[model samples]
Target: MAVSFLNRERTIATPGYSRWLIPPAALCVHLCIGQAYAFSVFNLPMTKLIGISRSAPGDWKLTELGWIFSLAIFFLGVSAAVFGRWVEEGGPRRAMFTAALCWAGGFLVSAVGVYLHNLWIIYLGYGVLGGVGLGIGYISPVSTLIRWFPDRPGMATGMAIMGFGGGAFIASPLSVWLMGRFATPNHVGVAETFIVMGLVYLCFMMVGAAIVRVPPPGWAPAGYSTPVQPKPLVTTQNVFVYDALKTPQFWLIWWILCLNVTAGIGVLGQASAMSQEMFRGRITAVAASGLVGLFSLFNMLGRFLWSSTSDHIGRKNTYFVFFALGTFLYALVPYSGAIGSIGLFVLCYAIIFSMYGGGFATVPAYLRDMFGTRYVGAIHGLLLTAWSMAGIFGPVLVNYIREYNVTHGVAAAQAYNVTMFVMAGLLVIGFICNVFVGSVHERFHMRAVEAEDEVEAAPVFGGR
Candidate 1:
């Protein structure tokens, strides 16, 4: 019965539907789920709940707690790939509502786990359940927005995705404030804080679910027209989601995204630690925190700025800049740190972070270009498995390389030099992959007859 309420079609784009409402609805979901990035804020307190700065008997270790986040991200990729078709068939309203339930309810369940001092339960609640929510919520509006604003696909996706980068910015300070409010000397307040946050996000996500609506069939923006002869790499032909994965273009883009994310997110995962370690006593903990915040700001900024710019310069060219310039920045980081130039170090990392986000924001548009809008959300969901892979790969690679260097008698300050160069090499590989990304084969494109058949198969209904 509850499923019927969620799955029922609303079809709210009557005669006067406005596209402007869509971005806000997307922002609400992305902003809520994006809090996953700020999971680190809880790591310190969770470890020290039973004892200050260390774990006592029965307390979770830092390594154990880290799995909570890892599990969530792993499941996010899984759910996205598994449920991509469901999201397309069920529509955004259903997907967003389900995402809201899983995300909010996961928090409440994790609160119970915290209260019971059960680590595994916490992992199940926050990592497994909440990660599914993150996956669905992340892609909920992507296809809808691309279809609605076909003229500006890059900008449309950028607006929603940028909120994801910004979510950590809001969640970090807000979580600290909430924890402080609920804390006592004896209680770390994690359980109560989780409950409060869960409820708050539930309300916020529902607002988006209520407000969002898809366009009526065949609808397009005013004055917009499909190009008679599509530009290079831009496709008017739709491809099925499964067929898209079989194409070389998809795998090439996958390599591009994986490498780009690996290079940038590796640094992001270590930003605060790297700053303090590399600069010796010159960079304080407070200053390192500020650097993290600055990274977030640039990450958010680049999503919109670079994606919007993609409309003018083309998606391929934008990625050229990402790989080429990003490679240079990654290689330059160790040098900037070696010279003890804090400003140069920060500037280099900031640019790298922005391009990291730009890679995310631009790829949806890129997919739209290569695969067409019909199955873009599903293809995009499949492509995001790269992100899931990179999440583990980047941090582990950085950590392992640094540890190896330290064990070999290298000073802590210079330990990351090899890792930085290696990451730059990864980006160089990504640059080569991008060079091979061209138009999909014409044989793979959806036939006009097939599109008409699909349209005929869909049930007709009146706008609500």
Candidate 2:
């Protein structure tokens, strides 16, 4: 009976329950999982696990350690696509609870791997299991929020997704402090840190699971009325989740998200190193880290600001700004370094990172526009495969290109120039993808009879 509490029926919102409470519930899980962005803080300490102060002969290479984040992201997409429908049917509470377990368990298992000095165990723990948590937790609240605030779906989703970006702001410093507190002469303290963080995240995410609820069927905000005429590209008809994939609009949006994410993620992953290398002596390690935190701040704010803006300007036009402006900014980054202007460099990246976060926050509402809300969450999950692909593509392109250039005697300052142009070019391609995205055809819409049948057959919640 306790387990049944998480069921879809139980989660249906009671009459007069405030919809505003939903965003905070979603934030609880997102902020915890958003710690993924700060996992980089653990990299060097993990490498020194064997040597205490440096890498021992048998110690894991930085390159080997890099796979941990990549695998986690890759599996995040994979698991979301695989389990998305289940999340839709079973409801947010069950999905969030499951994610909490996997995420916390991952830290425990990874702590054991750290103690034993086993790379495979870390990968299995954090990469596979934790990644599943990320995927499920990431999507669990999206549709629920959209349904709750159908009048302002973009703002609703943004409020929740912004937590994902801001999670790093809290996590990066917390992880560092925990490691410092636990470090000893013979030990790096990573295992213990992981244990504590896992427990903390588990507690926070469980709070989210308990608080989340679904809007009852046919619920709408007071005084809200369906528009007399649907806006361009905004669909009222539902598309079955699988039928969504058959539309060209889906793949175009897919490429749009992929290319946008690829440009941003590459720079995000390498922000500290890139800043230090580009500015050389002008930017110290500490300064570069401060820059990273600033970027995270803009990243979080952008999710809320830009996505909320999409509500007025339209999602398509918002992405048009992202690609058009993003291309110019990416191209401008190297120029800032060449001119030795720290202000210019920081300003350019700050704006760029904001749009990067914006792109993520806006896409769910965009999906609702193209596919309708009935299966939007599941479709959004499948679309996240683009993120998984970009996760690999962006990092490899940036890292390898920089390595190749440096090996050939390119200065650290100039080495990223070519990569910057390449990123700009990718955004150009993304801009064109945006141009091709249009409304889904009527052929893909679920028939009116089918829709009525679905509502009739659906289980009554709260025994109504």
Candidate 3:
């Protein structure tokens, strides 16, 4: 009975159900999970817990502590892929509630781990458990908003995803403030700070869970009509989630995402160092930090601004801009650094960062465009594995390229030139992939048998 209650569908929209409420609920969850990006803020303080820049007895070293974040991200991709189908069966409420518990509990448990100085326990709490929360929380509201705003999937998903980018900005400062508030002479207050954040996040996530509601089946806003125009990019047919992988379009899109992310994330990983190297010590540490912050703002803004722009221009065209314009910007970066143009360098990187974020926000809508809405959430979840892979590939590639250059007697300013050109080459590849992407084949789309099967298996509406 409890399981049934938890998995119940909210198929009926209540009177005066406001779509505006949905974005806030999504923001709440996203803003919380997005804290993952800001986890680095803890790295420095955590290293100094026992002694300044040194580990005393029972203290966790930086290398050991790094696994906590890695595990979380790994599990996030794993759980999302493994449990994504279940999210389709279970309503957003169930998935969201579960995510809230895992996310908040992960924090609370990590607090205990910190207090006891148990490194493995911290990994279990924050990495394994929190990662599960992140995977679920990330996609929880995505499909619902797409349904509610079918005409504006780009804008809808963009709003929520923008929060994920902005989340790091908020949590970075907030975590510092909280740590200071709870610090003792001998302790860095890591444990107490974790506990407080966990509780606060729990409260915030619950509010979203409570407020979120699914639209009624077949519901559309008054006067909104489904677009029936035959466009090459837009699909009227539905595709099942598993079958989506069988299509060439999916793989091509996947390739597009991977390459774009690899290039952007590589640069982002090197942002602070890259700025200092390019400017030849003219850029202060404070200025470099500010540059990083500016990158974050551009990333967040691009998610909303560029993705929303896709609603007017087609998704393919939008990506064209991303890859084409991005290729040019990347190629220009080396020249900008060579000439020592700080303003031009910053502007170019900022725009490229925005395109990076826009890619993330626009993909869901792109999937919906090609594969249809039947199982877009699941498909999106499957696609996020690419993110996990790119996360590792990006930093490693950048670091290796830079290291190779430095070892070969290259100057610091010129060290990243080859890397920039390589990144531009990647964008060029992505542009080709984007250009070749077509609609899913009809054979892979939901046939009569699958549609009938779905109807038979679907839950009863308005059930208590």
Kindly list the per-residue Cα lDDT of model 3 for residues 86-192, writing each as its tens digit. Answer: 77656677788899999999999999988887888889999989999999988888888898898899999999999989889889999999999988778898899
Error of 2 at 98 (Å): 0.9
- The true-structure Cα RMSD of candidate 3 reads 2.4
Which ten contiguous residues of candidate 2 have the minimum total lDDT?
455-464
Give the number of the best model, judged by lDDT. Answer: 2
Instruction: Kindly indicate the candidate among 1 and 3 with the higher lDDT.
Output: 1
User: Clashes in model 1: which pairs?
Assistant: none
TM-scores of the candidates in the order shown: 0.96, 0.95, 0.96
User: Each candidate: what lDDT?
Assistant: 0.88, 0.91, 0.87
Model 2 regions lying over 4 Å from their true place: 407-409, 456-464
Model 3, stretches more than 4 Å misplaced?
1-5, 52-58, 452-456, 460-464
**What's every prediction's RMSD, in angstroms?**
2.5, 2.4, 2.4
lDDT of 1 by residue, 158-268 (tens): 999999888888888889999999888788888898999899999999888888887877888999989898899999998888889889999999999999999888888
